[model samples]
Target chain A: MQLHYGFDELKDIDFMAFIPIILPFFAVGILLVLIALIDLYRHRKTRKSLLMWTFIILFVNTLGPILYFVIGRKDSERL
Target chain B: MNKFIVLIKKEFVQMVRDFKVIWLPIVFIFLGITQPIVTHYLPSILGALGGGQGITIDPSMTAQKGGEVLASTLGSQFDQLGLMILAISMMGIIQTDKANGMLAFILTRPVTVISYIAGKIVSNYLIAAFSVAIGYFASYLYVNYLFTDVPFSHMITALVFYLVWVLFIVSFTTMISTIFNSQGIIALISIVFLIGCRIIVGLSTVIDFVNSASMSKHAMEVLITGSVNSKAIDNALVTLVWIVLILFVTNYWIANKKFNHE
Candidate 1:
């Protein structure tokens, strides 16, 4: 089922309300990815599976950061 | 009581350190918000994806009701990715302690097996519950803004029933962690079984009584039609009983099973 929405639909959208609702989620997701990437880069030597985790944190959605936080780092049990 | 409370607190602290407390809900909220907005803007999404081809978005989808969006949130988003994160995040609920010799050390203490199991399940369940709540409410807000409001009381009724299933998932994960020795195995067992339950319920009425997935549909029924499903409630009750049975088994296994005690 395909429905078409043109520029007129943009006028109907409540960007004022919608942005607040969606922005943090976008920001958080991006920030987490960046944080995970930075961590992956800094701790490259200490990381158990550097190449895999970098790809994971970089490619996977929100879950990549979580996977890193939960298991990616070496001796992450200390976390 | 104090020791149990302390144990629960420790789990929460671990959750914070693991970044689960910080990220799980944010991720869930993001997922939850997507349901309403996506359903609302499916036309635009299709339009953008169409590229060179002509696309037709369903007219009915464009007017998705609040409850349907909420139901879709639970049915699609949570059932798939949510369960994975839950199982994956909790794979070490018991195995890590067992592997590190922490389980043996804790067992050597005066703490009862019941409390240890309860502490693990309760603390993790609390985070899961809170995360689900944040996600659910975020969806509710967007649905309210974008569609007609579903009855508040009805939504609550549905959630209360739905949370039972969530509790079962967490409790079941903890039990599987005890049975399995590997994180990969625990996640595999938990995900396959829970999702299998959801899928198989469709094939038979007898399975329906034991399948917890029906509870999700039941929860939505209360919101969408304002009618409760008695069979679904019965299934939830059976699920609750199964939860208790699993916990008892986990406790027994934890007490008797030999750990490498590294």
Candidate 2:
């Protein structure tokens, strides 16, 4: 119900509070890596593009995986 | 009918042969797993970065007596499933095929354009459904493991609605893919539509009937909360209309156009 947390409350924070919020992003990040590896394996010849995607996905966080999902996975032919 | 079946079979074969097929299920499963995990952990991660200014969270108090926590958790998962993964996946499928000239080749086959388009739509839908199921189930299992007192029934209901909501997304993206040739363009358009629908729904109080057609409006009211309201029904119908219209246009384009094979 309470979405916002005050800065003063950080001192006595509970671990349970962190579990729900961070878990999804973490899962997404790992999944992105897995998907990238699969793509790399499939398109072995396109190592440069795959590597570029890997970096973009790792550094970009939530939007990174999304970018890869849309623009990154597209074939050279489409470009 | 025979030609349709053959086309479907051909499409399936191609899907299987392509390593990208693995990506389809993997993307969904990954999203499913991450959706809940991210929703649950995001606040804390932000708090950690805030250091001394970080917000304190009371776990026992927050997790204290209620099914609301589970509801929120599932709700967040659905958001990721519907908004991010489904839309992205749909565009990716269509764009990839087109980029590779697979569409051109497939068009030359004996099958009618309608059947070709239908088979592709069906395959993508099935894949999306399976991915969402996996994600929901995984989330449910994790929640059950974490909070023993939480009721499983709520999670089950949430999962059902979540899947139904994602169907709208899958259909919308499929249509977008059919209409748009470029992946970047389609992705941009889909994002705009996704965000635009939400904005329209939010401003519906000022704009009468506009809210009725917004997918987010009904998806949130019906599928997210498990309520079957008229608005939700309207949203579903609107999404269906888009799907039909897009497919018809795509089929017509393919049927009427002549290809030059070099």
Candidate 3:
């Protein structure tokens, strides 16, 4: 099987033009995933499903890190 | 008043340590920027796919303005995803304290139930507000560059008016958090209620008057009309009443709930 759109078709795409637009999204997504990883590693005891959360945050793109932020970290009972 | 400041400070410190200080705004900024860039590129993306699949493209689908782009930042992004994040993030505000024995400890002090709950709500709401502002402003800057300069005053007005809706969201989630023991229940109810408001409000004017989600539509209207609509004010007043009612109920719930004291 071949890729649906070949490199010849990709020639239509202006890499230089698209790079500025795509870069911000990539930077934000990667940064957020890294932060998610750091938080997961730090809170392994309090947090549930270290492996699951790591993968979710790492693989799921924009919404993944958000899901991690919203639901991942275990809230401590003690103040 | 002193106690409120102290409590607010404590809550703020916790927020910083939780990394909420960093994640919340950055995520929103990403979302704010993402919606426009994606929507703008959608035509080209589809065009590329269309050629591969032998399909035609619609010109109208790609056509949009700076105002609409700015509006969708709220209409689509903040209204849907942002609302969910707000609900889930604040889901355990009081429940966590109750679960961990902190609620009981705090109560034994001179702090009123009102003050304690107020402190939690205020601090979280401040973060939500800051996050939204940064995200909204960043998106607006991109919109100005990519599309055209939207009316500066009108955009500011729309945001300020839209913020009433945000206030309701933050308070509503905090109240739901206060009432529920399970974070699962809290997240579920808050999301369902907010989403329900969006669905039902547009169906009837009576519902619209009370629906905080309408504020987003009204906010968009301000940009399109180039002036704040009176209805946005009316909706803000009604939502303020709702916010007060939610907080009141939350205060009552907190006062009565049984906590584990260790």
Give the alpha-carbon lDDT of every model. 0.80, 0.57, 0.81
TM-scores, in order shown? Answer: 0.88, 0.69, 0.91
- What would the C-alpha RMSD of candidate 2 be, to one decimal place? 5.4
* Model 2, runs deviating above 4 Å: A1-35, A47-50, A54-70, A76-79, B17-21, B33-82, B92-105, B147-164, B205-227, B258-262
State the weakest 10-residue window (summed lDDT) of model 2 chain B: B208-217
How many backbone overlaps does candidate 3 show?
1
In terms of TM-score, how similar is model 1 to the real structure?
0.88
Per-residue lDDT tens digits for candidate 2, residues A28-74, read 56776666556656766744577777777678765565566545654
lDDT of 2 by residue, B1-262 (tens): 7776776676678656654455555555555555345445557567656664646566554453324344444345445344665676567655566657777777777667777777777776666677667655665555554444445554555455455545656666766776676766777787677655544555645442333234434433432344545554555565566567767776775676532224
DockQ of each: 0.35, 0.26, 0.36
Candidate 1 local lDDT, B103-205, one digit each (tens): 8898888999889999999999999888888888888888898798988987788888778888989999998888778888889999999888766756878
Model 1 gets an lDDT of 0.80
For residue B184, model 3's alpha carbon misses the true position, in angstroms, by 0.6
List model 3 lDDT by residue over B75-128, tens digit each: 889888888888888888888887777878888899898889889888988999
For model 2, the local distance difference test gives 0.57
- In angstroms, how far off is B196's CA in candidate 1? 0.8
